[model samples]
Target chain A: MVGIEPRVTSYLDYATGGFTTQYAAMLVAAGVCDTVACVFGANPRQATVGDSGAYVYDPTYGLVNAGAIAALGWTRYMSKYETVEEDLGAVAVTFRRHARLNPNSAFTEPLTLDDYLATPYTVWPFRELDICKVTAGGAALIITAADRAGDHPKAPVYIGAAGRQQAPLELAGDEHLMCYAMTSVAEQVYREAGIGPGDVDLLMATDSSTAAVIHTLENYGFCEPGGGGRFVREGGIALDGEIPMNPDGGQLSGGYLLGWLHQVEAVRQLRGECGERQVAGARIAQYATTGRWRTDFLSTIYVAE
Target chain B: MPDSVDIRANEANEAFEAFVGDHELRVQQCDGCGRRRLPPSWICPHCLAEEYEWIAASGTGVIHSFIWYLRPLDPAFLATPYNVTIVELAEGPRLISKVVGVQPGDLSVGQAVEAAFEDGPPGATTLVFRVRETADGAEG
Candidate 1:
């Protein structure tokens, strides 16, 4: 029993709702969770509005509710089913067709779906390929004791449970009338990880937009919230399918740091060390985080045995 | 003539003519739970109510969202890209103006605006909202 999820503690009122209430008070100040799991998403100064009119600034159409779009805090659970032009043109055409099959993608050339619908609207249903860019990264994680799995060198993943929820700060004044609180924190993290989102395989969430990663893969019940734009327009979540989300090009082609490097690439694809963005025999991964507009929720349930 | 900048421009032009002699864009309104208050309240933020009610706005509204800045984060707003909105008001409150004549690809979403004011840097005034012509006359 050595689980130690530190995940950034009090970085000076980092303010994205004080960095998920200081990373759930630094996972109960380090003795790693007697119960600590604060989560967050949608942070551009908490979906900005400060020209100071209090809440809801316009200064010329910056965020006029579609539930105050910053990609509705997880793309409003991918708009409960999809259609901001088919979940932003199928994730900017499947990340420009997987950045033409990866080249450390910072945008691997040819993008067209009319260049993701001519880019620029930043919110009204979303544009600029449905948001998420800001970069400058850092990531770290370490959790011990799955019966001290053969004393380290990589091979112990089992946590199997973690759930968090928040939702009220006067709900950002009905944050433009709600819906996507990651579908009740993905129904209490799949009923406290009793597991069954098709018994998971790999997901590493918190996209920050592309409609909150197609409504968090349809709020983690894995495809149902508007069926995540026909489950990513068929092909299910492509890297190989059946589960493969954010095989790294997440945070929109991998960069946005607020997701702690998508939870350090889900502990490097459960330690197989993601060489070509791995995802082979993954055994039940899942990591979720969203806050503010998605209303602060987090989830974790690893298992590589 | 710095007698403390002429007694701070005669106490801010007598608090801007007691808020335009009550046509009321005076703002404060939070007597605790009415909201419309901003940078002036003595305490009330939804029920803390120290008591306030300078209210008057019906100065009209719309816009609801906007952006244009083009790239100026301020070099004195570099040759003006401006626009910036979020109006709302029909007195239910929203605020954050300065739209002017419209351009940044002709900003749509509800349009119609009003409340102007201006005159800062001395007797100080500053409210800024423009893009008008609606009460049915059209042009949003």
Candidate 2:
């Protein structure tokens, strides 16, 4: 009851996190509404027994007799990115970074870059770290009129502007999976918000895949396309940088609960509730939702005084 | 197994057939404001003009950008990594097509390309394109 309706159900088998993120971001940017409630879950009981007791849960389980959700993540990698190595690389980097600061996170042990590189490949491009752990949790939000937001217990956060855009849905038919959609959405969002990349204070994006976070930053006008990886390497998105990103450890470090937690965290930041992880003097924040193999996206801008 | 099969065309796609008959790619261009329409339009996208004209494209251009798919979203194109490229045609229009006959790593920005059609199920032919070597003997 705290968020929007229709739930924006996406078949995990056919849909990508990028698509869901973009859908949420665009809806907010278009002024249709500000604030969205995102929910993500999987039935771990539907998982299949694999090597080392690891289970795979299939999003299309009732429809398709595949493995567990973990297996589905593997198949997505095999069919989408082609190599498990690349997929695992994305997962490992995200998890290792997130585990350092997240107390509620499921996997909290410190992971070295070498441990991530050496983790067994669950799918060619995906590893245990590359895939999101299938957990049962639900999250919600309240998106209301920004001007009248201060009436609530939390201070009002203004949704300054938002943008949504997509490429052809079919991955094979898209111009490029690694680029395109994010850049287009970013250009439109910046135009609508009437601000430049340097004006942003922080970012809360759907980090389903490592490439997704990097590419989205580039596409959102922070950096040029293909420069996302370099941005991460340069610590550009860190807490102390000119533009901070995913201060809450994102979906990678924070468990996956659709993207509802992202919205909640953004609100928390606007209200100055985040301890230690807070970016000081933060006033404006950006959140990007991406899907359809990085070819579809939506972005929203928020301002809090 | 074949990756995809084209189904029969419906009445809404008769113009697509005329394009195949002439071996020309035809898109509706708005006469009122000179905007090229895609997905076929009944009215001009820019000025909402009911009037339009059929224009033939030169079908030659450079690859403005591209991406290689290691995995197949469609069961049909699963075995091979397909290259999807955006071609900036000589007519100043951009079209999306599969870049055939090139390795994924070999692709470069501004690569020259040409459009081609793949015959689909009865009366339906999908447009596909391939990269071409440059006039100066440079392979893209």
Best by TM-score: 2
- Clashing residue pair totals per candidate (backbone < 3 A): 27, 29
Compose the digit string of candidate 2's lDDT tens values, residues A65-141: 11122232333223333243433353345445644565555455676667777775433233445445444455545
Query: Tens-digit lDDT track for model 2 on B1-140?
Result: 53222221232146755686556786667789887655455655468786777787766777655545454323334453555555667766565565666775766556677777777566666666777767787775
* Regions more than 4 Å wrong, model 2: A1-96, A103-136, A143-201, A208-229, A252-258, A269-285, A288-305, B1-12, B73-77, B135-137
TM-score on alpha carbons, each prediction:
0.35, 0.59
RMSD of each: 17.5, 9.6
Give each prediction's DockQ, rounded to 2 decimals.
0.07, 0.04
* Superposed Cα deviation of residue B22, candidate 2 (Å): 6.0
TM-score of the second chain, each candidate in turn, equals 0.29, 0.74
**Using DockQ as the measure, which candidate wins?**
1
